[model samples]
Target: MKIFLTGLGFVGSKLVTHLIQSPENQLRVVSRSPSATLPAGVHFEQVDSLEKVINWPTLIGDSQVVIHTAARVHVMNDSCDDPLEEYRKVNVRGTLALAEAAAAVGVKRFVFVSSIKVNGEETFPETPYKADDVPAPRDPYGISKLEAEQALQALSSSSGMEVVIVRPVLVYGPRVRANFYNMMNWLFKGVPLPLGAINNKRSLVSIYNLVDFIGVCAKHPRAANQTFLISDGQDLSTTELLQKMGRALGVSVRLLPVPVSMLKLTASIVGKSGISQRLCGFLQVDIEKNRRLLDWVPVCSVEEGLARTAQDFLTGRRA
Candidate 1:
């Protein structure tokens, strides 16, 4: 199977590593930099911009599957005047352009690595989000992803190109960064956090599990034209997650049982409502579709995944 991959970021690089382990997969990666350290026997192409017009037919030639992992991710301290348009330029326009080119070149399947935010920012305690839920993107990043999914679906409908969309929750693993990594760092340092009272449930996926699922989707016959909501198949509260992280790091966490309502009020007063919401919000996904339809299960357990990540962080493998 000839596979063309985009974005050599954390997820893309890991996916490349996993795919190259199989001799049957002929991998080609596109990066903006010429100095990317790709595995042996894999081909590389350099492209300055995904939104710019390029020779797509040649780029996607002989590739049976195109896995798009490149996107304009969420910007916390955005400086742009119109963040949505900025995001659209890369995530929406660039993604659709690549898909169009891949379809034009007769790619067998297009696997789009989407975000769970497309379903919504948060879910209710009793009601988990299903794959078939109507999209209600609240943020610019989520809106862009939803638009890209819609565009890909339209393209797949118009053309005969099979499309598989995987909306994954917070992906954490060896090279993990952002809020999850920060939480791990806080746990490693035994920082007392005001999240003991946060009983909100959040679903997360390990990078290993996500890459495994992508590999399955790449070749699974039943995955064609399907949208999947993937997770670790386990929901955890903020306190539980921090405690697990502490255990992974071989340390004990100190959690302060601050009132959830007081925390929200203080966060709102300090203009940190977003952070508070993420720390005290419910965001669970129902991954039954992936399990039942494709008979897929997570390759790494949450504990194992967290341990690996903590070990990597401790050893300075991911700093």
Candidate 2:
């Protein structure tokens, strides 16, 4: 089978690795630069602009599936004057362009990787998002992702191009970056962290498990026109998460019991209430629908996933 992937960021890269491991798949990647050190047996092209998309018509015309994992992730960089507009350009417009291109060429299926934030950043106590729940994005990134899902569904209706959307929460493991990186740095140093009093529950996904689920969706007949919220199916408090991470790093926690209210106040003054809230707040996803629909369960526990990540960190196997 021929599979085309757009985007080479963190998730995209991991997806490519998964595809390469599949013996029956021939993979092609499209990006702005074609100079990536991809695994053996993968093809590439450079897409300079939305108008300059390569012979995607011909490429996807013969492909079995197209997995769209490329996007401008949430950023605090200064280049974004209007974050909403910036998100729309790439996450929404670029996504539609790619989907339209695929549809034009008669691609069978298009799987979009979306964010859990499409439901909301923080999950309330009694109400977690179900597959049938309407999206309520609270940030530019989430809004763009939700908009893209809508566009793809419309395209699917008109062109008979099957669309499957997977919303994953806080994917972590090898080749992790940003927040996970900082978290690991602190854990590895055995420094005292101020997250002991954080009693909030959050859901996280292992990159391995996420990629595995995507592989199932790629060919599963039951996955057509479906949307899934994926995680390890384990909800954990922030303190429990930290403790597991510390254990994986072969270190004991030096947690300082600081009050959550004090942390919130400090974060607000510094304009980082969102990040602080994520570190010290409650956010969970209900994955029962995914389990029931696809009969899929995470193969690795959180502890096993964290151990792999810790090994990657110690052995320099990932960045």
Candidate 3:
């Protein structure tokens, strides 16, 4: 039951905390962040960088499953000279190298944490992105993830290494970074947010549930060579989402009911269109395949997930 895990970010760290609780699981984690804390008894290995090649064959030895969560994360309003090339270096090529070496060293399964953006960034109301929908990545980061999934599938076929791809939407939990964390801070500090009138629906997965699904995908025989779209199975509008966060944080929302069209216009003028799109976009995912094929259900409800995150934020348990 030896498992090799890469990336010690919010998602990977949570996965470790969950997996190490099982006595039957032997954990080996590899990451460039040597400063990351791990539970006692988990073996750790350091690597130089994701984009750089290492002796992965030696590093992944005797592990039955590998969960890869490392990559160059998506940057909003990217100013890079060549964002696609930069993302492909780490997300695509780096992943292929790791999977190839894992296969060489007899790793049985590779679980890839992908993004819902691979099915395009938006969906019409009541029409969620399906598990088998054609990939239509709108940005460089999404494109890179899609490419990595393709490469992994080919390697899985030729090398007999099982590959499971899980595409999750807007994962939220303790120690979340980037915009989600920023939104939480605003809610905590009682900032006047202009998202009250946004009528867009978004599907979100809790970190606890996502890690649980990853564990299931790692071991489930039916998960081999399949892609899963997962969420809390509850979709919420932007206004409702902020309201819930406000309640969780024990604060009243100073949410301004601004017009969505005006907000988008202002964002366009200021070159922050991405933020506006996220605030007023419709992105829902259908997790029917996750239930039908894997018989999996989310481990926690959204209310519980938000409550845990709120507790951590108030107490400074994780950052």
Candidate number with the higher TM-score (2 or 3): 3
Local accuracy of candidate 3 as per-residue lDDT tens digits, 1-319: 8999998888889999999988999999988888476899899988899879678988888999999998898897679999999999999999999999999998999999999989999999889999999999999999999999999999999999999999989999988777778888999888898887888999999999999999999998999989999899999998998899889999988989999999999999999888788889889999988899889988899999999988888888343
Across residues 144-178, which tens digit of lDDT does each residue of candidate 1 receive?
Answer: 99999999999999999999999999999987888
**Winning model by TM-score:** 1
Off by over 4 Å in 2: 33-35, 49-54, 77-79, 317-319
Q: Write the per-residue lDDT of candidate 2 for residues 50-143, one digit (tens) a residue.
A: 4346566865657779998878787854366789888888888888988898888878999999999899878776566776788888888899
What residue runs in model 3 are displaced by over 4 Å at the alpha carbon?
317-319
State candidate 2's TM-score.
0.93
TM-score of every model versus the real structure: 0.97, 0.93, 0.96
Q: In order, what is each prediction's RMSD in angstroms?
A: 1.4, 2.0, 1.6
The count of backbone overlaps in candidate 1 is 0
lDDT of each prediction vs. the true structure? 0.91, 0.85, 0.91
**TM-score of model 3 (CA atoms):** 0.96
Q: Give the C-alpha miss distance for residue 132 in model 1, angstroms.
A: 0.7
Model 1 is weakest, by summed lDDT over 10 consecutive residues, at: 30-39
